[model samples]
Target: MFDSYSISELGSIFVMQGFAGLILFSVYLLMALGLAIIFGQMGVINMAHGEFMILGAYVTYFTSQAFQHFLPALFPAYFFVAMALAFVASGTLGMIVEWGLIRHLYKRPLDTLLATWGLSLILQQVYRSVFGPREVGVELPAWMMGSLKLTDTIEVQINGLFVMTLTVIITAVVAVMMFRSRWGMQVRAVVLNRMMASAVGINTERVDRLTFGIGCGIAGVAGSAFTMIGSTGPTAGQLYIVDTFLVVVFGGAQSLIGTILSALSISQTQSTLEFFLSGSIAKVITLLGVVGILMLRPQGLFTLKVRR
Candidate 1:
């Protein structure tokens, strides 16, 4: 296949692949960032992370429906409202779970995993009962249902660009909240030493709830963004969970910089392979490669030096 293509044609293909890789990186980072905050910062394994994303997707779907039926003039702009609602809906559920179940299991990290896993199943069933088993297609506005012509031979989907932009904005805002603000300091302190943070007058419980809520909220945003590229269903979240976990763990828990780097590396590698191979083979190769490397450095790519 390569022998027939001219150099310029190959270059264009490579560029297109790179763009696709970047979009994939953005999506992965968005999904993993929330999990990182919950597991890495709060030491809680939120198995319902994918469900939270599904909630967001559902919210976006409903928003689109409402706009199309009742507010046709605002069809294109419904996405903004949908995004906000998804964040609130998922964040509220996260806070509720934290208070109702997670709070009791704070000292028992392993139990939280089981509890959240059960919650995930419950949520999935509820979604299935309400939405049925079939996937719901999200309707995009006319303005968003097109592609941008980058060059004579290369064109990119507008939705991909939208997701990339959303990812950048969310990353910047989260970075600022995690590193530059007083709440961020408290969050870091709590992650570093929970007992010491409590001793120093930090409200550890509040921090925990907020951190988890933020994580879920980010997942919701990711789901909303994903409506452009994938299906919306109860099980849609399951598709991304494994990859999300891979990014979070491989990037190193509690390290935003590490998450971004790992997501970029994994996405680029997987996307490139996908261009030449089937999706399943590409995923298997990526997972095996990550597993092999992680076996050598169990602490991941960027281990924090805080005393445990």
Candidate 2:
């Protein structure tokens, strides 16, 4: 039923599609950035990353309920508080998991993968038991529930803009921490050469825990943001895991810059394709393209100089 439209109509469709792509890019970046840090810097395969994200979403849900019940006056501001709480909740869980399990598996990356995969299953079941099998709807404040119309046919949702802004702020903050701070120097040193860094008196273990926690924390924030645009279920995080991994792997696991680039490229490509084809078909084509490119350049779009 679809056909070519007038110039004005075509322009409106393109604008709407581009904005949609931007929202998708922001979510993908958030999901990939955390995995990039843990996998690239610490060499730990956190297969449970998606579960950590779900933890954040659940935290936000509860935060909203609390605000609605006890602080009705602050209901409009629940999202900010929810975001902060989600970070802390997910980060704390990450720290505990690191101390309890991941710390011992640092020397065994493959083993960590299997362990975290099992942990992910455990977390999923726990969420199902606690929250039930149905998806819970997160209540967005009225301010975030509408759209901004650029023209009669062109409109952008406020929530999408909020997510895009959040992504930009998070990316800038992370870039600063990675490139400008002394801790960032230590993190890079550890990533480049763990034994050498340890020999130089760097507390590599501390760095590892912190890096993992930060990664999980970011995932939480992402999950919280995602509730605005997607369903929130016990298994909602699973839906994004594949795409998140695709972005991180295709972007180059060791580079945040690569992660952002990969997310944008993939999101834009998928969005454009989705406008023409069914979502399932678009995804299939996009994935096949990614696989073909990866087969040609196994190291991904970017690679660090360090030998692994």
Candidate 3:
């Protein structure tokens, strides 16, 4: 990998690839944040999480089409509306799923996993029925189409920067909501001790529903962000679910900071490696490294110490 390129050329390649890694990091963090909430905090193996993300993608596509058809003048600002709608749509459906399916499967991780996997298939078929078998992409505004010329050799996409910005804002909001807010305290309380929380006047059921909804909502936002880089298909979400789950598990389920750090590490590693090797080889190496580390440190990179 090194013999063909001079030092200066290598420097530029590293810079460009590092930025690509950063964008990949942003996506992993965004997706893992929601997985952390659902699987890490709530202990639900939601295989259908990706479908929720695809739902948001479809919603964004329709939003873009509608804006282009009916509100062309204000099209640049349509993404904001699309994001909000994606969150609402995914979250509402999540709450309904939690109520209709997940709630009954509490304490049965295997059952939840199988059920959600089935749900993922159902959702995929539904998407195919509604959107047809073809993949669709949203039309970005003119402003998002260009790149920032940082230097002679390094340019970054405006849309990539936009996605990273959204990830940071959403991550900050999630951190505050999980740590500083009153409702956050209630959620932690319930997670730590559901019986005690219920005795103390917390509505555990409502908390569960809202937490799941918020997780799904964040996934939706991720899918909306994804439209910037890739087209959306019925099976697209499935491509990322395993990676997202690995991120959550490798981070330590109970630690939010762990989640962020792990996502960054895994994404940057796989991304940079992909530049030097085939994509499949890069992924194999990344997975092997994660699994090897996990074998040694079963509790993950960080674990919260809590009394039983």
- Give the top-scoring candidate (lDDT): 3
| Model 1 bad stretches (over 4 Å) | 1-4, 305-308
Per residue, candidate 1 scores C-alpha lDDT tens digits across 235-289 of: 8898888888899999998789989999998998898888777998998999999
lDDT of each: 0.89, 0.89, 0.91
- Model 3 C-alpha lDDT versus the unseen true structure: 0.91
| Candidate 1 clashes between residue pairs 3 or more apart in a chain or in different chains | none
Please give the distance, in angstroms, between residue 125's alpha carbon in candidate 2 and its true position after superposition.
0.4
What is the per-residue lDDT of model 3 for residues 236-308, given as tens digits with 9 covering 90 to 100?
A: 9999999989999999987889889898889888888898899999999999999999999898899967686
Ranking by TM-score: 3, 2, 1
How many steric clashes does model 2 contain? 0
> What TM-score goes with each of the models?
0.95, 0.95, 0.98
Clashes, model 1: 0
User: What C-alpha root-mean-square deviation, in Å, does candidate 3 show against the real structure?
Assistant: 1.0
Clashes of each: 0, 0, 0
lDDT of 2 at 284: 93
